[model samples]
Target: MIELLVIPANQSQRRPNWLRVKLPVGKEYASVRGLVDTHKLHTICESGNCPNMGECWGAGTATFMILGNICTRSCSFCAVSTGRPLAVDLDEPNRVANSIKLMSVKHAVITSVDRDDLKDGGSIIWAETIRAVRRESPATTMETLIPDFRGIWDNLYRVCEERPEMISHNIETVRRLTKQVRVQAKYDRSMEALHRISEFGLRTKSGIMLGLGETEPDVIETMQDLANTGVHVLTIGQYLQPSKNHHPVMDWIHPDQFAKYKEIGQQMGFKYVESGPLVRSSYHAEKHLFDQVV
Candidate 1:
C-alpha cells in the first residue's frame, strides 16, 4: 500500500475529516461543565484545547489540571498559556476531590502545569491532590500527568509517595526535537523520570505528539527508549498547532500509519498503546487503566 501525506499549502491549515470532533452537547457534558465551573476547577480538556473534549466531557470524564491554568514553560507546540501562575491554591486538592466525588467518575485523570516557580516544583500539591481524591472518592482510580520537575528526584519522590494507579510524565516529542518542542525540558531527564517511576513498581505512562518534524525512525527510537525505561503505556497522536505562533503542523498522518504504530508499540512490549490522529494522553484513559493484555 502506498502512503500519502496532506501537506497544507499555507499556514491557515484545514483539518482533515479524521480530526474533526462534534460540538459538546448532551446533559452529561453540561453537568460536568457546570461542576467544573461551579467548583472553579481547571481541566486539561479546556486548557490544552483537546480535540476530544466534547466526546470526553459528554462521557463524564475529563483530565483535571490542578495548581493553576498558567504554565511557566513556553513550549513551542503547546496551547496552554505561558506566564506567571497564581499563588498555589492550598484548597485546590479538596475542590478537585470534591468535584470527582460529585462526578462519580470511576477513573479520574489529573494533570498540572509546570510550577517550576515553586521550591518543590508543586509535587506537594500533586501528592496532596491524589490523597484528597482518594479520601473523598476511595473507589475512583487515577492517573497523574505530571511535569519533569527538572529531574529533581526528591520532588518526584513526593508524587511517588501517593502511588496513584498510574503516573505519567510526557516526553512530548522525540529526542532530536526535545529542545525545540519543549523549550526547557530534557529528553534524557524525562527518560530518567520514567525509569524512577518504574523503579517504584508503579505503572509508568508517557505520550509523544507526531508531525513535529520527526522521522519514522525517530519515533521508533523514542518508543524503544521509553520501553527501556519500563513505560507500560504510550499515546501517539498528530500534532495540531494551537496557533500560528505555535509549531506548525507538517503533515496530516494517515489513520493507517497510526494503526501501524500501535502495532509497533504493542510488539515493543507496551501493554496498551493509544495511537491515532485524535489520540491524546488522557484519551480513553480508563481503558488504558485496565486493559492489560499479556
Candidate 2:
C-alpha cells in the first residue's frame, strides 16, 4: 500500500489576521443568496466552501460552477465532491445567465467540475453557458475557469469560439508534487491547455496553490513554466486541506510571502497577478484584469 504522508495538524492554520471574515447576514448577502436559490444555481462560494463567499456575495458577485457538482477527478486538496457526475442540466446555462443578470454582475466567472464521463468533457455546455451569459447581459465581461478537456483540442476549440474575456485552467501545484496533490491531472497537459488557449488569442490565465510541500525554487519554476505558455494572468494561493481525509498542508505561507510572489509574477511578465493567502483563482479576478484593461 502507498504510505500516506502526514504533516502537523496546524500546518494549515492561519494566524489571527488571516482568520478575519464577515458573517453572511447582511441585506446584500441575503439578497444575493436568494437570487441563487431562486434560480437553483450553484455558486463556487457555497459548493467549494470558499472563504470569501460572504464578502463576494455581499458584493453581488460570485463564481458559478456549471456542468455538475460531482467531479470525476478527486483532487485531495479540493472540497468539491468526487463521484460519477449527473447528466448535464440543459437549462443550467439560462439559469446562470438569469442569475448573473439579476445580480447585475458586471463581470462574471464560470467554472465547472471535471466531467470525464462526457465525450467532450462538458465543453459544449461551457460554450453554451458563455453564450447564454453574453446574450442575457451583452455588456458583462465573461471569464471561464475550465477543465483541460483532457487534451481534446476540438472540445477546447468549441469553447474558445464563444470569445470569453479570459480562459483559465489551473496547474494546481508544482510539477514535483502534482502527482501527489493532483492525482488525475498532468503538469505537461495543463501547460498544453494554457498554451492552446493562448494560441487562440484569448486572455489566457492559470493558477497554482502553494504550501503543498513545494519549495521556493519549485514555485518559481512553475511560474516560469506558466509564463512560457504565454499565459497572461496568474494566481497563487496557499493550500488549506478541506478535511482530515484530504491531504495535509505543508506550511501556512505568510501574507508577505504571497506579496513577494506577486512581485516575482509581475516581473516574470504576467499581465495580472493575484497572490495572497485569501486569493483563489476567481477571487477579485475581474477587478485585477479589469483594472489592467482600464
> Per-residue lDDT of 1-294 in model 2, one digit per residue for the tens?
322222333743544356456566788888887877887766777877788887777765688889878899989898888998888999999989998898877778899989999999899999899989989999888789999888988999899989898898999999999998888999999999999989888888888887788877888899999999999989998787788899987776777778888999999988889998788888876665544321
**Best of the candidates, lDDT:** 1
What lDDT score goes with residue 235 in model 1? 98
lDDT of 1 by residue, 1-294 (tens): 333444442653687788887787888878888877787766768767777887777765778888988999999998778999999999999999988898777788999889999999999999999999999999989999999898889999999989899999999899999988998889999999999998888888999898777777888899999999999999999888888999988877778888888999999999889999999998888777764423
TM accuracy, model 2:
0.90
Q: What is model 2's C-alpha RMSD? A: 4.3
Per-prediction backbone clash count: 0, 0
Query: Which pairs, if any, clash in model 1?
Result: none
RMSD of each: 2.4, 4.3
What would the TM-score be for candidate 1 when compared with the true structure?
A: 0.92
Candidate 2: where are CA atoms >4 Å away? 1-16, 24-30, 37-40, 290-294
